[model samples]
Target: METILDKIIAKKREDIRNMTELTINDLDLSREKRSFIEKLRHTSEMAIISEFKRASPSKGIINANLNPAEQGALYESYGASAISVLTDVYFKGTFEDLKTVREAVNLPILCKDFMVERKQISHAKAAGADLILLIAAVHGKDALKELHEYAAELGLEVLVEIHDDEELEKAVSIGAELIGINNRNLKTFEVNLGTTEKLGPLVRQSGAFLISESGMKTREDVVRAAKAGANGILVGETFMSADNLKQTFRDFKVPLTVPQR
Candidate 1:
């Protein structure tokens, strides 16, 4: 029986077969990529990496009517440090969404997909991605390292994701500068902010910028993650499901008042 991750990989391989229409050399590697790392480094407003996800396997068809370009523009105008464009077809996304978002916003764009091959990195560049996400759980340590290096060679930064301690070690060993501690379990789909807090110390020791991903729904959640040493946060559903996207972002931007002891 194939798991969700397994199904996604099989589909990615199928996508690669169709990618023969364009070769690596055919891609314009020199296209100026905005610096995703630099944007994260310079931000002081909780470093929100807002994601534009039309849908997901877990939650189908979030906002099918949403215009990618318009959403991207709104995210930028509301002070998102960077934008994440979901490019996985399984999740109702396309590379065109990333390209459209890139054209609409000045912020760096992250290609959020289950990357399995070198060609996927090329595809990201072709689609105007400045960064790409690599889940440590799916690729393992060796493959993750290779993909990370490949993305860098193409001038794309990487956001290496880890869901547990073992995966955290792999990311640190690879010298991943941008590390995302996912609060949601891929297998069970259970979410807990404690994942970030528990893994926070190891991440700090590795000297990597910590990005807490998933389940961040309010100003309080942001404060909790920050107290755990997360330098950035990747929020999606909370902001995407909002009727007032700008006001939603404004709410996230407000500083949290930590309770005094």
Candidate 2:
């Protein structure tokens, strides 16, 4: 059976083929690199990498009228440690959105997309992205390693996303320091915070910066993740649909030292 992730990857390959060459000169590489790891490492509170997501494969058309630049700035003002811009067309996003956000904020920017090619890393670096996502489920161990190294070569950090222990081991084998445990399963789109609870400790034990991604809606949810040993949380729909972005961001910024019950 073809999953949503399979369909997205298929479309992405076609998009890459049709993509026009984006030379380094064509992009504004003048922006200084903001370190995503450094920002998270130094923060006393649970770091929040707020996302500028227009939609998702499961949830469609979330705040379609949102201006990426404005949203990015708002996230910064609300104490976001970094800004993540979804750069996949399947998610109703584009690289233009990442660029716009880059121009508007100085926070570390994550280009959230299914990265399979080195050229995509080049595009991400040129667009002023500080980090790029590499999904372990989408790439073989060797491919994942190659992309992780390639991103490093371009001075961009890799947020290796893993779904299970096998994928986590693959990320660990690649010496991935930044790992995002996505709670929403890409295959079924079913979200369970327990995904983080189950995998977060292994990541923490491996001495990697653990980021819990997706399905974070409330303060309790954030607390739950923090207790699971997440150094940071990647929140999208909650922030995008928020009537009060500042409060919502603040509410979700639980202390990393949150006491376990």
Q: Please identify model 1 stretches exceeding 4 Å from their true place.
A: 21-24, 254-261
List the pairs of residues colliding in candidate 1. Answer: none
| lDDT of candidate 1 over 1-261, digit per residue (tens) | 667777777877887787744466777888877886776565565778999997887888887888999989989999898999999997788999999999999898999998888888888988899999999988778898999998898889999999988999999999999999999888777899999999976787788888899998888888888888777889988878988878777767744222111
| Candidate that scores best on TM-score | 2
Clashes of each: 0, 0
Error of 2 at 256 (Å): 0.4
Q: Report the Cα lDDT for residue 106, model 1.
A: 88
Task: Tell me how far candidate 1 lies from the true structure as C-alpha RMSD in angstroms.
Answer: 3.2
> Candidate 1, 94: how far from true, in Å?
0.3
In model 2, the Cα lDDT at residue 159 comes to: 96
